[model samples]
Target: MDRSSQCDEPSSPAESPSPPAAHGENEKNAQFLTGLRLYGVLIGTSVASFLISLDTSVISTAIPSITTQFHSTPDITWYASAYPLTLCSLQPLSGKLTTIFSPRWTYQTFFIIFLLGSLLCGVAPNSSTFILGRAVAGAGGRLSLYSFGTILGPIMGGALTEKVGWRWCFYINLPAGAVTVATLFLFFHPPQKKPATPLTPREKLLQLDLLGCVLFTASIVMVLLALQWGGNQHPWNSPLIIALFTGFSITIIAFTIWEQRQGDSAMIPLSVLLRRSVLFSVLFASLLLSSFVIPVYYLPEWFQIVLGATPLQSGIYMLPSVISQLLGAIFSGVLAKRIPYYNPWFFLGSSLLCIASGLYTTFTVFSTPPAKWISFQILQGLGCGLAAQMPLLTVQATLITSPAQIPLGISLVLFAQYFGSSLAQSIGGAIFQNILASQLEQEAGLDKTQIQELLRAGNAKVRETVAESFPQSLNAVLEAYNMSIFRVFWFPVTGSAVAFILAGGIEWVDLRDMASSEGSENRVVDEFSKPGAKQGGSRAGV
Candidate 1:
């Protein structure tokens, strides 16, 4: 059982491996930061993480406000999907950019880009600018920082939307980002690395794989257009939508061929993708992460629309789920440390997700009990939390013996997460919009124009508008929204079921044992964690 056999082709060395001296951080430069200085850097990184994480889900609660302001109900899917679309597309390139430039410089550049994106979003006069700004903000440099934002973004967004305005959601990021820039400039510094030789401009551009990125991005955009337009704006049988789907398949094939040719220089290296554990991790992570995001986006809508809660109230309503998720993640880490296997945790989590998604399907216009919703949310959160982080960990453990694959493996898992989330939001919007339209037309007797008007008015405002004009039809319209939202549960249910199936196929090893030897521990730190040694000390474990 050689490690190379795990890949489709034997694992090859990197195209241009870093030199011995470039292993990261010279001994003399590794002096410890102490007193106030270390704390400043730590707080700075955490604040940066917080801001990035907040951006990931902040739009969840602001959608209704944004839709109202832009009056672009047709483009609602783009509002949610745009960020993830760009985020997923650029994630692989971020690491390469970080390596080519120093981390500090790269960090500063991305932060500035993110700040500009936020400013644009805050002052956006039209839907196109807002969506473009979101895409730019989403593609801001690091996936790891975004992961933290996903955890707390909804609550922050909801509160901001309620207190100030939806614009403040974007505006808040400006000051926070300014602080991050200041801190990084003042406190953060990685040892400088001089390339063995200066590279030509063409060589530098080739290292970034710009062509492959464009092809892959184009393919994804085609798939999104197909999904967004089919059976919604256009018929499923329409030639335009069909052509988009066809183009997606062709471009994906071309991208695959290109990746194979690039070998080690490929953005998502072909050899790493061929590994069985890596494959399973990508699938499982996509499914599980989608499960997490679907609820985050929709539950607030449910709270505001069905229960007549304000934005702040909707955020408050989500406390059970958010709190439970954090608890479950903490417990899962503790359990993983002690247990030799991960399948039990996976099974437990997915089973809970299945039950929670099923329970959500039971929600109705009259289902206003706080306890029922809270309990269901808690269950769903616990389920996703328990298994959400496992895919990455399991992939790392599988490649413990093949350290070079760790970075690619981690990146693939993360890419699946963002990509799946993008798909989930797009599909959810399509389903909800289509069903809501039909339900309003057939059940509530609203015409096409009226339905569009109502949707453009915003979810909370829709109820108010209808109640004032057609009081008798209010209940019917609310019921239509309820049923339409309930239908969205199927997405997470199916995602959880698939995750449960994939979890069983994951390869597991005793991670603690894998890192027991000092040399192996160093290897784990070198491979799975950050590239450079810390200013103060070295960290152990994968």
Candidate 2:
């Protein structure tokens, strides 16, 4: 779908378009693309996003199977962690890549890379090979819409594993990705805008900040390595872990210095980071949006370990939260488009998210009432749904009239989200494992030797094997699982609290007016209504 509106010529004050009328009819029309081409592109985008996001959780359900097949126990976390590690590392670079090359070409290139990774994963003969494939896929699809992909992954993985095999999980991506690629190739081409300057080939390559990206990737990977191994593979105070942490800090500092010096050409441009909306949006995505990752990752474990539900059943149980989130986002989008004021919605969403996190913390092994967990999930999903896309939306609204800045704005928000999610997951895993280990020893009455063996056995096996072999200790083990998951809830609670505070700083942008030529001037309008305001008119300070 070549949905190219001629880049609106830079408008003079007197050349601005007519104000959008009541009902935001003009604004709605401006955003819509008619014809089958549009539909094809939209469908292709959704399918691509689904596969990308699904990768985040698909391997999770198949983790045990993969471990058993490969006879690898130590690197189980890497199956999941490897993808996001590369993803978070390269997402910002992908955004920059789009700017320097054709968005269509860049997207297709990544899609191809992702396909190869999936193929490798599907046919892998060992854990190392499989992890490598996941990392490759993660790097390629890092900029794809993974938030949505993850929502449906567990169920898809379970069903696929049950029907075909665990290998089919990665194999499934091949056909789906091929179909999406073909559709996109037939229909998708974003409107092209001439670059501000025609750069030499060398200049364009330099603009990508390859060195900075490598340094930053190294830094993040080091930190992730430390997190993954700490208190599990190695003692928290081990010199190797300490060195990794130190290397991360040093490398990150170097990357920051390089980026600051590189300025506009840097992978993450400093100028964009300096903008108020961009800065806040990054924070909101990192702290608030990423909080969603907690339950998405652990809730399945909760169901499997604590409640003894199968992976498919656990995925089904998660629908309340997932569906509510989808609905909340839709409702909020409608409200944002129709109403001029959106900060209140942001405020409401964050406040609700905080409340929901608090509610989930109350979950216990005995709290098996479906109603309670379902209600809690609904609340969390609704809260997340309302606010999930707001940060990026705000960034776009602010840059509506500045087409050139839109890509950077989006990339910044996504980087924050991916980075935050990866960080949270790593830390969350460390916390969960450490607590589970301690609880098994202290509360489950396991001797040190038994605890060590259990820790090595992994959560899924420990729960199943312990329940069968040690009936008296099963209750204690389940309780420990409950507590560990509960403690992880505090991270999101704290994150949402911070998000609520930061959300207050989001300047109000009316979607109705954002379609007009004067959007840039009015982007950061006040939230309150003006006196004697006309129905469906612009708000105060707009």
- Candidate 2: lDDT of 118? 91
For all the candidates, what are their Cα RMSDs to the real structure?
A: 5.5, 8.3
Model 2: how far is 1 from its true place, Å?
Answer: 21
Q: Pick the candidate with the highest TM-score.
A: 1
TM-score of each: 0.90, 0.81
lDDT tens per residue, model 2, 1-542? 00111111111111111223332544353433459877877777677767876787786666655655675545655675677677767866665565566767777788778878999999999878998998899887754544456566777776776568888988888888988788778876554335457888898888678998899889988997898789987998999999999999999999999999998777788888888877887788788755777777677778877898765677688788877877887687666666666577667777888888888888889856999899988888888878766676676666656645655676677667767777877777777767877887888888877766655565556566686667779889889878988898888899889988998777776555555655443432311111111111100000
Indicate the worst ten consecutive residues by lDDT in candidate 2.
Answer: 533-542
Where model 1 places Cα greater than 4 Å from the true spot, the runs are 1-25, 35-37, 141-152, 508-522, 526-542
TM-score: model 1 vs. ground truth: 0.90
Best by lDDT: 1
